[model samples]
Target: MTTTTAIGYENNLPTNDPASLIERTIDVPALGAHDLLVEVRAVSVNPVDVKLRAGAHAGGFRVLGFDAAGIVREVGDAVTLFAPGDEVFYAGSIDRPGTNQRLHGVDERIVGRKPRSLSFADAAALPLTAITAWETLFDRFALTPDDTGTLLVIGATGGVGSVMLQLAEALLPGVTVIATASDPERAAWVRELGAEHTVDHHGDLAAQVLSLAPGGVDWLFTAHSEGQIGLYSQIVRPFGQITAIDDGPRDIAPLKAKSITWHWKLMFTRPLHQTPDLIEQHRLLDTVAGLVDDSRLRTTTTRTLTPINAATLREAHELVETGRTLGKIVLHDGN
Candidate 1:
């Protein structure tokens, strides 16, 4: 029997208590035909990690982590994209056991070769946020280098925002990216990442955006659309597109008058639904790795905790729950 160290929880409890997570050895299941058994070297925490951890536990222990970079230790017979010894980065499928374990199995279709220029910890921070930002800008919103417009990004200093601003500057030429940051530090952070202007999200977001683009922004991407939907509707220009990566129950009725198109960017959709376009994730991740190597995209890893374990993971969760994390926090293998 093969087993690996993992951080898991049997109950959904507040991360503030520090006893919410536990460490244990878990069985590593045999791989499926298209699976790659990876030896996870580093893993990053996302809001989803916290959400899933806080949700009701379905049964036994639940391991929660999505972004990871590691070396391929074994591959199932049908796996062709990667093989033993290959280094890769990926956001694991939401329905499957997560990447919190030392050994994780993920479909090769959703994994990509890691950026050779980055360390395991840095690479681990890119996958989840990169996929979400890439999909939001290029796929959902369809921004192109040829198209010129203003892009308004709400919550522009966190993990996804850090990558989104960089991708916008790298992929969409002639576009002015305005990001909302509630503090001076975060504002400076977004500007460093390529945001042309920074507005306070806690203040009058619409007025601040209006001061920059009198007619309102041509496109908007927000991680807090549910709470800021009304503000979004007011600040996005007519016919503008909006992509929200945050979980929804967002009311789109306010968008009707402007004839705006609102879309959701769920990075895990391809893998979770087994969509035919699952390979697109692999292709985009590959492109992201290339961009990273080219210095066109920067890793958002702001902090790393050593010796991946329950205490460290719980600490990461606490940071995430603060809702003020500037970038991604990663956990590196103790060994």
Candidate 2:
């Protein structure tokens, strides 16, 4: 591949419009001093991508994607973390154009070495989900790697929840992990990922959780309905932390009464705002890579699509929108 041959989807109209599927040829910006020009091998679709595309302001022929694994084709003068020909993977900044293309210009601070044990498609599934799970557990909840308290993972079969289950199981040894999945297959899936117990979210969550722990759960990680905040409060012990990745219009007063600590995990906030600690994403991703390469953790890519294009991307988006995907869905460059 030259400095080009990039393939990606471009939406010129609102996502609700029928003509939003337009595709075109364009040049990615040259590498900045702190950037890496990556030859994208695989990309993953997340729910945020679908939500953003469906919004009214989805314009400017925007390139929309986040998770990607690829080869570093060129490095800027200031880049030191990676070199040309290095293999890398990352969940690109939401504020920047994304990695849906064959070529992507990425900031070095947000990228990490791809796990040596995983394929490009597998590695592509990890970055976004891993970042969310890590930030939610370690950053937002302030849970240490060795904390052995019982953690209740609501909706633990979804993308972020799947990785969260693995991270907790791998890093927090002896910690009782109670995961919630609505169906039998999803419940089994979470168990296979190392969850100690799985409960049905459609049932009484507090009762089911109590049946397992007897004492209320010490920590709660919710990847599902924000409307269930009250349910979380009932299941978490007083002074316990409850972190969620869901955006809410629901009341958290139930948590207030229980003295439950509430935290919202938005993985894109740091990169989107360019916060002072934005470099932490890079550090976390690097740590995750180490875990992957060492075989302590696994990539979550569950589905793959051939050739990156608009129609294929639409299919991936539709699957995510269905709310039943077991892990990550990826699209490779058809190499």
Candidate 2 residue lDDT tens string, 266-328: 888887887898789889989999998888888787889988777778778778878888888
Q: Give the worst 10-residue stretch by lDDT in candidate 2.
A: 6-15
Alpha-carbon RMSD to native, per candidate? 1.3, 2.4
**Candidate 1 lDDT by residue in tens digits, 1-335:** 48888888888888776658888788985899999999999999999999888886737888888999999999999998997999999999989988999899999999999999999999999999999998988889887799998999887888998999999889887899999888889989999999999998778777889999999899898888766668777899999999888776546888899999999888989999999899999999999999999999989989999988888999999999999999899999752
Candidate 2 segments whose C-alpha is farther than 4 A from its true place: 1-20
Each model's C-alpha lDDT?
0.90, 0.82
Candidate 2 Cα lDDT to native? 0.82
**How many clashing residue pairs appear in each of the predictions shown?**
0, 0
TM-scores of the models, in the given order?
0.97, 0.93
The pairs that clash in candidate 2 are none
